[model samples]
Target: MKILLTGISGQVGWELQRSLMSLGNVIYMGRNQLDLSQPDTITTTIRDIKPDLIVNPAAYTAVDKAESEIDLAMAINGVAPGIIAEEAKRLNAAIIHYSTDYVFDGNQNTPYRESDLTNPQNVYGKTKLVGEEAISSIGVNHIIFRTSWVYGLRGKNFLLTMQKLAREREEIKVVDDQIGSPTWSRMIAEITAQIVAKFQQNPSDFFSNKGGIYNLSPSGKTSWYGFAKAIFNDDFSNNERKLQRLIPITTQEYPTPASRPAFSLLDNQKLSDTFGLKIPEWDQALKLVLDS
Candidate 1:
């Protein structure tokens, strides 16, 4: 089967290129080749490629910047995916889109389920929710994966940021009040490939019975401070650059333009039960990333 993969430059997209390759032919495109900001370009690309599946791992991910650049954010995060979904419908192809945990307002103390109501507190989350609604309205075969706290070896993510800071600075401050699972992009790609293989083996079983949103994250949770401490302990043990002071602070102390969910952990029971898949612990996944 021929698959069209977008956001080839992103961390998840980069890993997905390798995982999806075993299944069939994958035509990868980055923003330069297929910019999400251009609706006509997305429609034309999908029409021209005529892929059996379209894996969209791209979005306007500037969470804090979205507050200032609402139009650009909405165009890429909200409007573009809608056009892709519409085109996929016309081509009778399946679409796989990635969302975020920010869709929730962070009020719930327990892990979030797929059925939980979404009340985004920030502009970035609102636009992503809009994208989800658009895809749902298209009435096509699509699977939306909501993930949280994604990190990887490459790309600008929390893990890399912490690593760089540990090397350059003597001390660092991280938010301890907010908690979520740290997902490895590699795991996301692997799970996505597994889902695609399942569908390929039994297309009717998936299409006629199951095809909807599912939370794709690691099994455990941690705060930003904990995550950073773990990284520092693992990456630099005896070096002079080892983190000397990791000051834990609240979200309000280190404020950004976007308001993040206080507790963004997602329950994976639905995804595991539906796909017969098991995710590793967040720390194990982090180790794998660091090792790689």
Candidate 2:
């Protein structure tokens, strides 16, 4: 199977290069080779490659920056995905796209299911939701995995930010009011690879019966402050310098241009029920990432 994987430079993409290798001829595309912001480039590339499956983890992920750069964000996050799905439909191929938990308003106390109504509060979330809609509207075989609070060692995520701050500053402040499951990027990649492998086994049945949106987050939840605490607690590297105290602050205390969902925990029950993929806890995934 010819698998076209996008966002090679991203944390999940970087990990996917390794996980998806055994599946088939993985044709990896970084931003330079396949920029999602450019629609013609996306259409041309997919047409040229003619992959059996297109696994897109790429998007305009700058949550706060999306507020200022709405057009650019929408182009990549919203328009590009529709183009990809269209191209995939032409080739009679399937697509696996990654989405975010931010699509919800976070008003509900319970974890958001796949069937829950999406009311994105910020530009980034709105754009992501638009992308999801675009793909589904195209009437193609697709698997949209909605994940939450993704972090890894390589990327500029919350995990790396917290670690860098811990080393440089005497104290750090993280939002405590907001709740989510801090999923490891590698875990996301691995699970995605598993799904792809399953798809390869029986593409027709997989798409006919199992194609839809599923939450792909780890079990359990925590606030930003709790995640920070877990990261610091699992810091196994010998180079420890500063970080005297860790301060927990409310969301209003640390304001941002983009309004995040106060509670964006995604329920992964559908994923387990369909794929039999039992993900680990958020903290457990964190420890594995740190250990590596």
Flag clash pairs in model 1. Answer: none
What TM-score does each of the candidates earn? Answer: 0.97, 0.97
Superposition error at 264 for model 1 (Å):
0.7
- Residues 1-292, model 1: lDDT tens digits: 8999999999999999999998989999999999999988998888888998999999999999999999999999899889999998898888999999999999999999999999999999999999999998989899999999999989999998988888888788999999999999999999999999998998765765778899999998999999997887644554757567888999989999899999999998899998888789999998877677
Per-residue lDDT, model 2, residue 123, is: 95
Cα lDDT, all candidates: 0.91, 0.92
Model 2 spans > 4 angstroms off: 234-239
Query: What ranges in model 1 sit over 4 Å off?
Result: 234-237, 240-242
Candidate 2, after superposition: displacement of residue 196 in Å?
A: 0.9
Model 1 has an lDDT value of 0.91
**Candidate 1 RMSD to the real structure:** 1.2
